[model samples]
Target: MKPFHHLYGPVPSRRLGRSLGIDLVPHKICTYDCIYCQIGKTTQKTLVRKEYVPVMEVIEEVERFLKEETSSIDYFSLSGSGEPTLHSKIRSVIEGIKEITSIPIAVITNGSLLYLEEVRQDLLYADVVLPSLDAVSSDAFLKINRPDEGLSAERMVEGLVQFRKIYKGQIWLEILFCRGINDHQDELIRMKEAINRIKPDQIHINTVVRPPSERWAVPLSQKEIEKIKNIFGDKASIISEFDRPPFSLTEGNIKEEILKILRRRPLSLNDLSEGMGIPTEELERHIQPLILKGSIEVRSFGESVFYEVVKEIQISRP
Candidate 1:
């Protein structure tokens, strides 16, 4: 299948196998200007939810992809650029996808907007909803998420609990933290109390593995993370690299796909490897020359390095 502009990454996911990412909102358009965000700062941080992308238009792209070619994708991920919930027509998109195929739908969100009944209702159709809760305290929330005026952390937590009570879906809550900020014993205990309210099926503990918008958003060590995992208990686990794609794309096409994706936005090595269905080792061989020739460059976002087009490459199809 040809690359769709709005559709990116049947990217390898650590938890959900190969995932086809559907970009509902434009780049960095989100509710939280999160300190640990891998993709960097938010350009529009708002509480307003609108039809960010035409829902029917994207459903058409999905139909084309599913009908034209076989995808090894385990799920269709409503995650790209920003929060999927902000797209007002996401419920329609989910419904439209259900009409086409039975593959499960997953949405990765910040959980900031989940407090709104409209937002929570819009996501009821999804099989999996992954939302993050980095801080439990108001002061910590402001320092971490940097949300808009009137957007309270307390309200967000209340919303999550309320949504959980009504919705019968998997809620895999993500907790992204940095050192000395929200990783202390007191902070961790408060987080546990807050998490109990949501009662997620799983607690995904992640850190700033990629370069973040804020340099101060440091990651906890593997040992430190594991120690905290014990405190958080059985449901808590670290999100790490899991399996490789079972298939591979033939030579020549891999580079084009990588270029096609990066032309839209920068991606980490793992993102490139997963999306292209190519091994990182082989991808590195092709990537090194592109970087050396000034076709692309590696940029660090936390500890993870991502590849983005150098902008002057004058991308004309060979």
Candidate 2:
């Protein structure tokens, strides 16, 4: 299979299964520079919405991949290195892909722009919309998310609430906790109140399980997160590791395939093994040479070690 410009991964997702990621915007162009972001710090933080990537090009690539590959992807995920809603023609891209395949579409967003009618409308066709609400108070929101100017915590909550009223699809609201930042008692109470108003179909509680952009961003213990999950009520659950059985790594060169997936996000040895359907011992053989050549580097977050491609290295076809 040839390299695709706007498409990536049928990578294992903790939430969406084997998700084929569609990048609508460029890397790090996001509204919030969240401290716990696994993909690193946001480079171009903005509220402005426009066609950052060509809509037709993205659609064409999806069509090409569908024709060339026979991987059983669970969802066509509108997520990548940056916030997807920033792409003005994302609705067009979603509609175009739906026309070609029966696969469900999922939109993973920050929910910052959901206050706008257009943004909410753009995501209506998606099978599931996973939007995050880490904090309900302005101070906590600012500290945790570090959003662009003019965006407030109240507006963010309101957007989710408004979207719940209109969207018939599933709304899985994710709340990522960073130790003391948004996990305080006051913030938890306010977040619970906001969740009541938003009425999301599911509430996924997450801690910083991956390496964060800020070193100070720390994760809560499993026990602590479970307590918060109880507080959020019956609908809430912790976002755990992807536990599904591995899929066969059909077609692509193993070395090139590893780089392709790692370029989008850091994955542990087990994550790569599960996503690639290869054994850890065999993967280490391919990984060691890359590490020696400085093509990829290892990072530890909590107890898990992850591999990420060095940003400066260009990914040329093998």
What is the C-alpha local distance difference test score of each model? 0.83, 0.90
Local accuracy of candidate 1 as per-residue lDDT tens digits, 143-235: 988988868889989989999998899999999878888887888898999998899999999887766788888999999999988988999
lDDT for model 1: 0.83
- Can you list the residue pairs that collide in candidate 2? none
**TM-score (all chains, Cα) for each model:** 0.92, 0.97
Over 1-318, each residue of candidate 2 has an lDDT whose tens digit, in order, gives 668988888887989888899988899999999999989999999999999999999988988998887667889999998999999988998899999999999999999999999999999989999999999999999999999998999999999999999999999999999998999999999999999999999999999887899999999999999999999999999987776666666433778788889998899999888877788999999889889889999988778899999954544444
RMSD of 2: 1.5
Q: Cα-based RMSD of the predictions, in order?
A: 2.2, 1.5
In terms of lDDT, the poorest run of 10 residues in model 1 is: 309-318
Q: Tell me how far the alpha carbon of residue 19 in candidate 2 is from the true structure, in angstroms, after superposition.
A: 0.4
Best lDDT among the predictions, by candidate number = 2
